[model samples]
Target: MLFLKLLGAALTLAGTARLGRLLGGRYASRTREIGRWRTALSILATELGFGALVLTQALERMALAVGGHPGGVARRAVALLHEGESSAAAAWRQAVTEASPRCSLTPEDEATLLDLGVYLGATDQEDQLRHLKLAEERMVGSERVARGEQAQRERLLGTLGWITGVLIVLMLL
Candidate 1:
């Protein structure tokens, strides 16, 4: 499912870029008046950027699903929770890193981690709270970046459509 979503995002990016280029060219030729090249370049850049963001997020999500705290760390955390060996936070951190050191957890993951940590008595509750806050900030940043890219792509496509329509109307007249 993650792979499919990533693939679809990639295809969307490519299609948007191609459509932008086609429309940009037509607009440039018709207007013969202003910054056609700049507009085209901007459209291309925005499309690529959006595609990269989607790909990166999708890849991260896939990695987390494959090797998150639940897979290994969660088990240890649960064990610690039951055995009273350590706290939930500590067990989660240890298990997650053990399973996959490369994991970049999201805000939701951090909340789960903190809850596990407290449940297991792994570390200070404050520390878990801090981690959760940081995760929230990161998630917000990622969301904003993604939204910006999406908006740019839509704007370019809309402009292209408008230009095409105008051209057709002119021809009909």
Candidate 2:
């Protein structure tokens, strides 16, 4: 019985600790995901501004060049465009909406992307490039905030997990 009690307590501690770590990792993931988006946007800007690619072609190239959620968004937008989504802005909005749920982007991040979509392919090349630059700037701000939260929250959650496990074990004892 005593051995069984020890085993249960050990399991509890391990499980809670793992759970805490998983939760904490989300903050870091959000930051990384934001960075990925920023990089992808920069790639898109270059493709549009210098490579002389049309919006759809630029998005396809961006998708090919990048990976992860940002890439997925670009790929989906391209697919939507090919499927007769009516406009580049519509496709971008739809793709961002679909990908937002699966990604670590905050609502604000999602909104920023959606806002960027509105000007996509709707204006001259210079305007399109300007919109892309603006979005990248917003993403930089978001990444900074996410990095700060990750730094502060990740370790705290991990420690709290262990502390909570200890409390639970004590109560059981």
Candidate 3:
């Protein structure tokens, strides 16, 4: 019976630890993704400053960062953008909205991204840069909040795991 109690405690602690790590990993991944998007937007804006490309082409290239690859939803949005101006905007908004739930971003981040889609290629080089900057700022804020929450959650889970384990073992006794 003592052995069984010990085993149960250990398993409980292990599971909590695993869950905490998973949560932390998720936050880290989100930060990386958001950072990547910011970098890509900065790059695009810089390119635009030198010489403007077609809006569709700019979006397609930006998709590489947003989608994480050529086959990403953002890239597909770029294809839709090529069809018509309104369709392209709708596609961008849809992509952002759909993607929000899949990651650790706030609704504000999604809204900022959607707004960015409205101005990405529709504006002049300076305005595009401004919009991209706004988006980057929003992403940075979101990443900070996410990282803080992740750290707190990890700590809480870790503490809870040990506490639960101890309680379980005591109860078994």
Candidate 4:
């Protein structure tokens, strides 16, 4: 009975630690890049293949569709972007939430994304690149913060699990 209890504790601690660390890393990695409707779309599409489509990806798909359409794709993309700020904002918010599980994004990150949507295909190449840079900057900052917290969070969970199991064992005794 004692052996079973010890084994259970050990497995629980190990699993908890591994899961925390893995999720943190995944979260950090998922936030490595941000904007430019097409680049964002391309990355999101790739993410889709992995079943991780986020709000940003949805924007990307919309941009790609509009840009890739055979007849006056550029003109159509422009019209959609011009549809209204609220329309773009809603989509941007959705992307951020969709990716919430895998990436912890700040309001600033969301704002930057919203800005990216506004310019989207509506802007010239240089402008698009600028928005992309802004998104990338935000993501990079977020990733750094996430990476710093990841180890600490993992350790905390692991230590707590260990301590909890030990306490349980003592109580049973």
Candidate 5:
């Protein structure tokens, strides 16, 4: 499981870097010829979006491994809670702190932490809730920035597509 997670991280990084370089090159050429600031901005946005997507996917996979099956970390934590081995808050905090460092948490890990924190808090685990909230805040900021960039790219692409269509129509005439 650990190996798989590591492999996923490596692949995500490689893919993101390759895509960024390809888009950046295209943006540079377009900007040089047309001086369209939107093109460069769009490229930057696309890169950010791509990076977020890759990280999100990886984190989602990790979250599933933790929360999904009977043998998962979440299940084990719950079991500990039931067995009176630890309070839910303590169990959650331990699980997150231990897992975060070992798993080399990506941005998506924040989302998982936020969800788990809320759950722990609901179950009367205030300390875990506090830490999870902090993690959530951090992740939310990054996500918002990434989303803003993605929205800009989408708008720019739409404008470019319309202009291209108009040019094609003129040529056809």
Candidate 6:
């Protein structure tokens, strides 16, 4: 009976701790994901503006250069485009929408990407560059906000999880 009780308490602590860490990790992931988007967007912008590449080629290169969810977004967009999707803008919007649930991006972050997509391949080089620049700026701001929250939230939630576990064990005892 004593051994069973100890095992139960150990499981409770381990489970709660793991849950807390997972929750905290989301904030860190969000910041990293935003940074990846910024980097990938910069690559795409360079490909479009200076490399004189078309939207499809630029996206292909961006997908190759970046990894993780951001890269996934680019790859999905490229696939959609090659599959007879009408426009880059529509492809990008659909990609972002489909990727949103799988990513750590907030609604605002998704909206920013969607808005940037709306301008892609719909305008001249200079306008496209401007929109990419705007999207990069928004990503920078979002990353900063995510960074600010990550440490505090992680610590608080991590501690709370252990405390809750202890409280529960005590009550059971």
Candidate 2 lDDT over residue span 1-173, tens digit each: 99999999999999999988999999999999999899999999999899988888898888888789988998888888898836888888989998877989999999999999999888999998899999999999999999999999999999999998999999999
Deviation in Å, model 2, residue 104 alpha carbon:
1.0
Ranking by TM-score: 2, 6, 3, 4, 5, 1
**Cα lDDT of model 2 overall?**
0.92
**Top of the candidates by lDDT:** 2
lDDT measured at residue 155 in model 5 versus the true structure, 0 to 100: 52
Candidate lDDT scores, in order, read: 0.43, 0.92, 0.68, 0.51, 0.43, 0.90
Candidate 4 lDDT, tens digit per residue, 1-173?
98997787777667655665565465444344332223544443344334444434444454555432211222333344456554544444444445444434556655656566575544555565566566656666666666566556656655665666566556655
Clashing pairs in 4: 41-60, 55-95
Q: Worst lDDT window (10 residues) for model 1?
A: 32-41
Which is the winner by TM-score between candidate 1 and candidate 6?
6
Give each prediction's root-mean-square deviation over alpha carbons. Answer: 19.4, 1.0, 3.0, 9.2, 19.2, 1.1
lDDT of 6 by residue, 1-173 (tens): 99999999999988888888888899989999999999998998999999998888888899889889888988899899999946888898899999889999999999999999989888999999999999999999999999999988988888888988888888887
Using TM-score, give the best candidate's number.
2
Span of ten consecutive residues with least summed lDDT in model 6: 84-93
Candidate 6 residues lying further than 4 Å off, grouped into runs, are none
User: Relative to the unseen true structure, what is the C-alpha lDDT of residue 156 in candidate 2, on a scale of 0 to 100?
Assistant: 96
* Candidate 2 residue runs with Cα over 4 Å from true position: none
Better of 3 and 4 by lDDT: 3
Better of 3 and 4 by TM-score: 3
lDDT for predicted candidate 1 compared with the true structure:
0.43
